[model samples]
Target: MAYQTFRQEYLQVPPVTRAYTTACVLTTAAVQLELITPFQLYFNPELIFKHFQVWRLITNYLFFGPVGFNFLFNMIFLYRYCRMLEEGSFRGRTADFVFMFLFGGLLMTLFGLFVNLVFLGQAFTIMLVYVWSRRNPYVRMNFFGLLIFQAPFLPWVLMGFSLLLGNSIIVDLLGIAVGHIYFFLEDVFPNQPGGGKLLRTPSVLKAIFDTPEDDPNYNLLPEERPGGFAWGEGVSWNC
Candidate 1:
């Protein structure tokens, strides 16, 4: 019964969010258990180019350091905002969400080459939060029940909090920059006069991740009875 309840809750999460959160958890657990080392997962362009350790490109965004305060903090933000975005504006649009991931990852990887940053998981989480917050500007958010602000200010608020924690704001800034670029191109600029859509979800991706809309037999919900009553309603149960 306990396992069944867990499964029900887990299955309630959208597919992309579930997979991303699971990956982050497993990666952190692996580090905690000494099954993997941070050096092997961090972003190192020299090793990536010389030793051909290309996995660093992807793994760098999976581990948020050993499980602790920072790791837990980042994981919470990542899971919450990612799930909200998936279930909100991006609902039933899996392909576009996947495209956003790929686009952001590519841009971050390119920037990581120039910076001395190692793990980018935190920055990636910030990017997710930034995008979602911008898309839902009017939504009110409270930060640890301390500071309350509109949705769009959440990322900046987090960056400020990181500064207070004595952590460098570089990673957070990188995330904000990349996120703004994506938002400007995908959501903002496209709506301006003489502007057009710059990001397009490919046909192949749509075919794979998006459900078809032309299913003739598809029923979203069961049909109701012809009248506002159920069959045999008049024949009440006899005690």
Candidate 2:
């Protein structure tokens, strides 16, 4: 029901999102006035997470680019993809964005930080996962008029491109972590859907995997066939 939820959430777009857009504009203006740097809270997790920090929950999304054209283009993309997601779920999905972005991003960030502090530099982990998302597993990306791998390729593509060429997205691990965690707990957390913990993880993973029509990752949608929802057909949050 990912797609159905998407439709519901889309109808309920959050007010905070618009406020965020305004805040982004205001921040840019402030920076232009030499009041503060654009990257002010890019790395200060504690400061970013403090109370009244609602903006922090959504700021990273505000950082389009400094240039007019690029920023506009990115905004269009954000509107297209993100808005589709928001609209797909209904009107309230924007709130879910805040939840997912914060929850998921934070989880990934914590994992990366933990890995670095407790283990080793594993930036490639994030990079690789992203690179792989550009395919719809069933369809291809429409690149310059040519349909490439698959539409589901977006998540990995965006992830990989960001890690490799976008920026040294060490901070992004935070975003990624929160995302998967939310995916894990979203509909069936605290209370197991499969009745008990015996199949909790797999069942939850399967739920996230199975999607309705308008899911963000097209590839994650259920296959085209006469049948009921199949858990194994969708993307399972592995690692």
Candidate 3:
């Protein structure tokens, strides 16, 4: 009964969000069960290129430390913003969304070479939040029920919160950089005078991931509400 209900709800989540979030949760659970360790997950260039441990590239973005306050906080933000982006602006464009993921992950991996950061899941989360906020710049956001600001500042606000928590700001900054790069290339640059679309989703991805418009069985999710939340809605930070 409960399991059936849970399965139905889970299936309702947009495909990209469902797959990515499920991977993160399962990776964490693997760690919790002692089947995996952070040592095996953290990104290491030497192992990746020299010894060919390629899975670390993806796994590093999966584990967000142990299952506790920090884990829950990151997961909430990740799932929330990721889902909002998919069902809102990127709705019916699964291939492009997946392309964005590949693009952002590639940029982060390149940048990770110069930084001392281990895991990058938080940065990836920030990139999603950043992109969504840029697309919905007018939406008001409330941080911790205290500070209220426009959507554009949400990434910085999260960075500020990270600083307050004694976490390195580097990760947040990395996310913001990659997010800005993506937003500018995809949204801003193409609209400028004499500027053309710089980011194009490969046709292969489209063929593999995007559903055909002529398909009679295709069902699109309902359009998301403004800001991905109701007006006057409070986003509680339980940490």
Cα RMSDs, all models: 10.2, 10.9, 3.5
Residue runs of model 1 more than 4 Å from their true location after superposition: 213-239
Q: Write the per-residue lDDT of candidate 3 for residues 26-72, one digit (tens) a residue.
A: 99999999999999999999999999999999999999999999999
Model 2 C-alpha lDDT per residue in residues 1-239, reported as the tens digit of each score: 99999878655554544444455566556666778665653434455556454444344434554647545544444434443333333232333344433444445545643543211112222322332232113333554343244444545454555565555444345434443344335433436656322213344433553335464675344533211123233334221
User: Which residue pairs collide in model 1, if any?
Assistant: none
TM-score of each: 0.87, 0.48, 0.90
Report lDDT per candidate.
0.83, 0.42, 0.88
Candidate 1 structure, TM-score to reference: 0.87
Question: Ten-residue segment with the worst summed lDDT in candidate 2?
Answer: 118-127
Q: How many residue pairs clash in each candidate?
A: 0, 52, 0
Could you tell me the lDDT of residue 146 within candidate 1? 79
Residue ranges of candidate 2 with Cα displaced over 4 Å: 1-16, 45-61, 68-74, 90-98, 105-140, 163-166, 169-177, 187-239
Q: Return the top candidate by TM-score.
A: 3
Q: Candidate 1's residue-wise lDDT over 15-76, tens digit each?
A: 89999889989988998899988888999999999999999998999998877899888888
